[model samples]
Target: MPKCMIDGKEVEFTAGENLVKVAKRAGVEIPVFCYHPGLSVVAQCRMCYVEVEKMPKLQTACSTMATEGMVVKTNSENVKKGRAGTMEFLLLNHPLDCPICDKAGECDLQDNSYGYGSAYMRGSEERRTYVDVNMGPVIQKNMNRCIHCTRCIRFGDEIAGIHEMVAIKRGNDIDITTIDGKTLQTEYAGNYSDICPTGSLTLKDFRFKKRAWMLKKTTTVCEGCSKGCNMEIQHEGDVIYRCVPLENLDVNRYWMCDEGRFNYQHTQDPTRIIEPKVKAEGGWKTISWEDGILGIKEEIDGQKPTFLVGSDLTQEELTHIKEYIALQHPGATIQHFGTPGLTSTQQDGALDQILRMKSKTSNLNGAEKLGIAPLMNDTIKADTVVVMSAGRAKLPKINAKRVIAVGVYLEGDASQFDMILPGLAFSEKDGTIVNHQGIEQKLKRAVLPRGKCKSLSEVLMLLTNKKARVGANP
Candidate 1:
């Protein structure tokens, strides 16, 4: 219960806590560029300067520890002038092309410049620029907007555990590049753009797609794996534009792996099977929702079934499937399948030293928690197999006489199934999923189900109740 005076207000902070956190409690703003809560505090940006009562000069709030009984002045003339000077210096060589930059609306450098910097320039010298290098397929580099904050450098070293990004030179000529201009090698490379205070690094997938201000954001969880890294899905016109990590200290912290970051791609894939289809004399024929349910009932009618639930499904969906099986198909066999070659949570381990897990599915632990056993190769003897999942789980090869797939899937994924009932993806449904650590997280609905896709619960209702209406939002 240590107390410190920030501005004029007494703020209590944990001993050894930095002034930035303490200032935040007292509603005092200390601008920072190099300091990320998840990364090491380098205090190199010098943008979060504050005037201490007994100290002669300003101190960097990001690195300064708050001592009990110490007074701080974040808005004093000395601190304001110090911050303005830092802003001016940072903007000295920064490109003034905010009109076209993708980071225009959300760029920290732009906001700081307008808030703390003087309107008139102190120097009319030529600005610095460098030829951009291709970091990789995930990131696009623009050295002209680089602020030399070293955030990406520190993130790669301290968090990612990969020392791939480095500064090649010193001072004004310093070029932040990979070793020998090699392409980015880390699987977490998408985070390079997320942690950048400026648009020096931007995601290639999100580049030029939409302005940062134009998209609507939905707080959600990543369905890529069991990590369940919190994320935000941004969209406009009911179309998802991008996904970014949401901070969860106990889980993903301030970062998400590239696999989870780009997992939204499949949801918006053009080749996805959006309409219900029934196999007939032809390869596959588009069928109405009513007819689709009728066809499924006819196929599974009077035949013993082996239900293969995808471990990628949320806990709510999994529980619903369990209840449905118990009530409707009492003698039917129900098992879970996901992440080929990986069955039980016992076989699941870290794919890397960091976030990636060996099991590709998000709810393998949840499925196990529900007393659902892993499906084995020998369990494919039933006359009909009903496969269900949101999307991340890969379908196992089925040799059953009749195969009924009831989940979001792509046309290319149609090779192993006989009938398809279009279902919602992770972003299109609201449910709960337990992660590898047994922490239950919520998967929020970002957009309505794309095309004719329906929720799994609704599909089950349609299958069970002849009176239930079947529609996209149902």
Candidate 2:
């Protein structure tokens, strides 16, 4: 085991690991602005200074490697002075509008200034300001507050594989903007606001909606694609404000595509069929929970049934659905449906070199693991079809005279269904989903189900033949 001394403490670290990582392991803090572990290190901000025992000058912790027996002083007076100076320069042009800023509570600039900077005013010149430009639909830019860290630029090149962000001028007069103010062109563009150290970049979807500290944070996994990027759902009183990527080194790393970041909105949509409905002459008519339960049972009891489970469902839900069908409808066939074109794990490949996956559903691999075959058009022998999903999986066209729809669905999507039973969305259920790499991750319940929505087990229990089935037989 290789070791290094950071802040007078001996710490074991991997060979070639940087000082910032080593110091963090040793419980020593090295302030940084431009360094992201996922992106290449540029060390432009120069905020993470540490005094090496034999070195003449302070070294940037983010760029310096901890060699064997190397001694570093992160808390030395010299290192403290260097950091204070760096903070002063970075804050000289920064607008002191934290009260109005969306990133106020979680802003790194504010935290570093309070912990490692001088309080007294050192400059008398007018503060720098710029007319903010639109980055895209997902990001809002406040260039007046940028510290020129160039993290967004590096993230675009190294991680996103796109070079949309760039710095125009050098030094103090520099401006970070896109080419000719064009809109962002990447599907993973939501990550720019996540990587920016300052309030210079923030989510346009989340801006001014709620303060950072006001929201309750729930750690969850994204279902936007097969990537299953870990994320945190921030909300106030069960109203989700935004979704930010949680670091999972083997999964989505520190980035999530824009599709997953905004996927929560569909769950809270006003047009979603959140309650039980029975089809009528013109359209769907809202029905009671007991009636909806009995309606589904009456419609499919005498017919040959095929259960079409969405691949987007978690493994727990899928298992429950499978067992219920096997026990109640003994000979019912169960087939999985997801992205229309992507049926099996073999067809599920990377949509791009980055995080975008060809399989739009999160649990496609999980379905394959469970030996569920993909739904094919020619295999439709059942008179009644039961389509179940968490609202993300696309429905396969079925030629059945009777179709029972369950799970989340938009009004237009359930127009032709014989019966609709409102079910929980991904955000409202607790279960497990396996990613494209076969890594199983948990999906935590972030918010309670809206209206009459119920869990899969509860919904399926209605078809049982005993007293356990919906209060003793309809």
lDDT for each candidate structure: 0.87, 0.85
Tell me each candidate's RMSD, in Å, in order. Answer: 1.4, 2.2
Off by over 4 Å in 1: 467-474
In candidate 1, what are the lDDT values of residues 170-238, reduced to their tens digit?
988999999889899899998999989999999999999999999999999998888889999999876
- TM-score for predicted model 1 compared with the true structure: 0.97
Q: Give the alpha carbon lDDT tens digit for every residue of 79-167 in model 2.
A: 99999999989888988889998889999899999999999769989997888777878888899989988998888888888888999
In model 1, the worst 10-residue window by lDDT is 465-474
The numbered model that scores best in lDDT is 1
